[model samples]
Target: MAIVKMEKMHLLALKSEQSKLMQTLQKTGIVEVIDITGDKKEEEKQGHKEDRIRDEIAKELAELETKLNNLKLGIDFLKPYSKSPNPLIYGKPDVKKDELSKILSNETKIAESLQRVFDLDKKIAQLKSEESKILNQIDFLIPWQGLDIPLEQLGNTDRTAFVAVVIPRKSKDKLEEKAKESQLPLDIKVIGEKRDDLYALIVYHRGYNEDIQSLFKEFSVTIQDFMGLKGTPNDIIEQSKRRLSDIQKEREDIKTQAQGMNQDLFNFEVLYDYYMVEKDRKTNTLKLFDTDKSFYLQAWLPKERKSYITDTISKITDMVYVEFTEPEENDDIPVLLSNSKLVEPFEVITELYSLPDPRGIDPNPYMAPFYWLFFGMMLSDAGYGIILSLFTAVALLKFKLEGSGRKFVSMFFLCGISTIIWGAIFGGWFGDLIKIKPLWINPLDNPMSVLILSFILGIIQIFTGIILNGYKNIRAGNTADAIMDQGLWLVLLTGLLMFAIQPLAGIAKYVALFGAIGLILTQGRAQKNPIMKLASGVMSLYSVTGYLSDLLSYSRLLALGLTTGVIATVINTMAKTVGGSAIGFVVMILILLGGHVFNILINILGAYVHSSRLQYIEFFSKFYDSGGRAFDPLRIKTTYVKLEDL
Candidate 1:
């Protein structure tokens, strides 16, 4: 329910045992390594030049990173062919320590498999490129297949020249008439017509080539080239088609081969994770400094794990020296939150906003109940609640969701329970479908009551925030600030609220006057000029409107709650109106199911967003001081496999 306490750690160990020490600390997963190698000023201040000594592991780390990348590429290539386990059912596959070692022992085989996959990918790429060119050649040949002369024979002779041209059909007659007028020793044979073009083979005497070319150019004819092609169009087309069939067969064979390597996919995954862990270990070494005989390291660890970490390091080497000290007031300490399992899920809410200050309180325990209440109130539908609860319950039990994933689902599960309670209270069981009597007042019949209840709830939350702020101020020994600022505001707000009650109306005015006078005196006490101070104090009273606005924001609770009920009722009414005949009844059932599903999805999103908005805007504004960095410790980080002890 609070930020975990941390302590600074300085360690000295033999240079030879540095690797062992790092491995031990990494397995403990409790230390955040820091680089002291570049702290020249600190080293000079301490008069310990030994701290400046640093080791270079960049080359080794880079090599390991390259290996990891290759392994990742191989795994991705094989994923589609592999029988991957469903994350919903199996989560991440776990690799035992012994199993990891066994997999690594066969590293030679895995490397060969990876190389094979790479080669196959390269070969397939080349084959596809070749297939594209062949298909284009076939397209060109298909339009000229009627020509009988071989392509090589269409080049030239000493006395005669051969050429192929395609000219627009509208200009064919004109070109022929022009050729006749020129009387050039040329003959044009129309091989075939395709679309708007006429494909023709033209033979002309070499001496009259220029004249024939001029005649052809009059029609905007396009000359065709089949350079170095030896066979006729039909023969070439047949050969290219056969080659295409072969390319297809070869591609299929390559795919089959790649699929056969699916069993080795896990091996690739394990090796990738192995390299990744090694890379992390090596990368952290950059934060360390080493001498000829010894090495120096600095880190921060949780106070609670001090004994455990020290003991683990002691077992690794007896020549090691370790010291721990309290963090300085100005130290930029990383924050790690600790909370009970029941309250843990709501930490996601705070994190989504921002991490709380290390010196401040964890807001999860305080904000969870209000968020749960608000979310349920907004979504208030018993049927939807039951469905949400059951679905999330199954997901939580079946899937090994980790980190924020698990927290979000668990939060929703709890919200579902709250929704069910509120729905039952309001007598809303799927919008009057079950005919259940009201356990409380229905918002539709008397919205004013629900509206009042929402404002009251909002007031309670706002007051709670102010109280927490006062507590924080008191903890920091600013008792006067707490009372003058927070205490007086609470007094004024509470007194003003009391004036609405019949029994307390007589005393409420006096209480309100005292609170207002106190605020007017204290709010601007820091102002030096008398006139300015009085004016500032008077103006401070105007902020009551902000609090009033905050209270009004709770109107959304009633609005959303009523919206859900009204929409559900509309869906039911529309269904009944059409459910008179057999076909209509079928459509009615579909409409009910689909409409409710859509309604649930849309409203759930709304409830989450609006509920979170209230907390961030109205509640947290009073006390939360954010902007703390998260704690990151050195541990085995694997993507495909969760490492476990055998």
Candidate 2:
């Protein structure tokens, strides 16, 4: 594993040729454009405006961004209706060179189609709003269907005042008594009842209005207003039902029309990618410095891509100037990992933690083996391993996964293989559902053996990390630090282990003492005071406890490994208990299926989390130097389609 070497790039081209050159660079997809004009305003503040070029593409970029947003909205609107292929099965739609060119030239067709979709979406929105209002009206009117008078006719006449009131069913009798006491021309009619309230219409003489109004308020009356409605309750409900039916039909028609334009959705995606390419070019163009007739561009790119970029640009225009130079020590060089196909998937682990420093060693190749072993041991079930391997293998073969998605699937596929191996070694096939002889030791029968194995693996990995740290120090010309730090620790640990052997006990004591003396003398060499140096060196021995704690973390491997097998065994036992009759057999099958699936899912999560913990906390902490920025170049990035030519 290695970090790809990078070089600084300087480019000068005619202002007229800027667009063409940018297009070329984007297609190459290697150059990371540097923003040299970042301090334009600062320079202007200092009264040096002659060297500044007015941002020519800013307005165009803004317009393009707006158009892109609208286009994206249109696509999202139609996505529910379109019969798009499943991304998991088909990946992004691929457009060949001729197809792309054809779609690019037919911009008018796509624009018209997008407008039509937008119009239909707007229509649907309006229809939905109308539908909501009609539904509400229908609900309100259904409770008043017994009211015979039209809503408009319920208003006051010349002699009497008419008002619709709703009061509690228990308050109805009190209102009747109050109306009787008023001795006015007050008529109260119970029109309808809903829940705990009665809908009533009250008509009273205007001369008795104050008395009738007071009685109405004292009876807990709620006045209903249908002032904007023209028809009776029954008439309004019927009309609303008819309108709802019509709205439903109209919405269905719109959905049908939108679904019919799914082909245009694909074309819209192509045009989106085209605009994206253009937008990126314009964005990077702002990073350049321009004069009256020429522009200057600076970038960083992989050193190996130098010849390819130079040749490609030279073919386009011979007048352009290009230069490449070694990156300076202080330059913020971006990190790109390069590894073998087998080791590549493990890069996702390092990436999730952080990319390794450009000047340090790549840890993927070293950390991957331990991660694989740990994951397999944690999920040691042959049947589940087979399923994982087959599923991931099929996905890798049938689906076009890219970037982290591809790496993740690939990693699980390899981990599945490791699981199979460990499963066989531990004699764990579906947790003893199938009778098989032990290839090695059954962890359930002899857990201590497996615990010892986990500890040994942890010790080996720890030593590997320390050696890698030593390598990094040696590479950086810090041999003294490597010997005093990594070398002495290894010696001490090795001697401690040797103490377990009877024959080496005598030598082990001296070996351990020598390592301790060396660390005590050198670990505090940076301190100035002699007394402080001795105290610091004495304190350094406490780190052995930290190392012991890290080593203990590996026991999770045995713990989780046992957890998977034990749970599988419990499921099998439960399933067996239910199996006697034909129906019982069916129940047993269901239990086995559901239980094993759940067990696999839960343990897989545990394995992944714990496995990564070992790497990040135990392994990487020893040697990994993070904080390098990832490489992000100006290139054609698309969401819905892949450009075959590019």
User: Compared with the true structure, what per-residue lDDT tens digits does model 2 show for residues 1-646?
Assistant: 5899999999999988988899889988899998988756754432334334343477788888987997898889888998989777888878999999998888888899999988998998899899999999888888889988889888778987889889899998888886777676778888888889998888888888888778878888889988589879999999999999999999999989988998888888877777887888889988888876788898999999999999999999988999999988888889999999989998998899899888888899899899999999999998889988999999999998899999999999999999999998998888889888778999999999999999999999999999999999988999989999999999988888788789999899999998999999988999999999999999999999989999999999999999999999999999999999999999999999999999999998999999999999999999989998999999988888888775
lDDT of each: 0.88, 0.89
lDDT (Cα, 0-100) at 639 in candidate 2: 81
**lDDT winner among the candidates?**
2
Clashing pairs in 1: none
Query: Residue 628 in candidate 2 has what lDDT?
Result: 86
Q: Give each model a TM-score.
A: 0.87, 0.93
Off by over 4 Å in 1: 41-56, 131-245, 644-646
Give residue 78's error in model 1 in angstroms: 0.8
Q: State how far residue 376 of model 2 sits from its true place (Å).
A: 0.9
lDDT value, residue 492 of candidate 2: 87
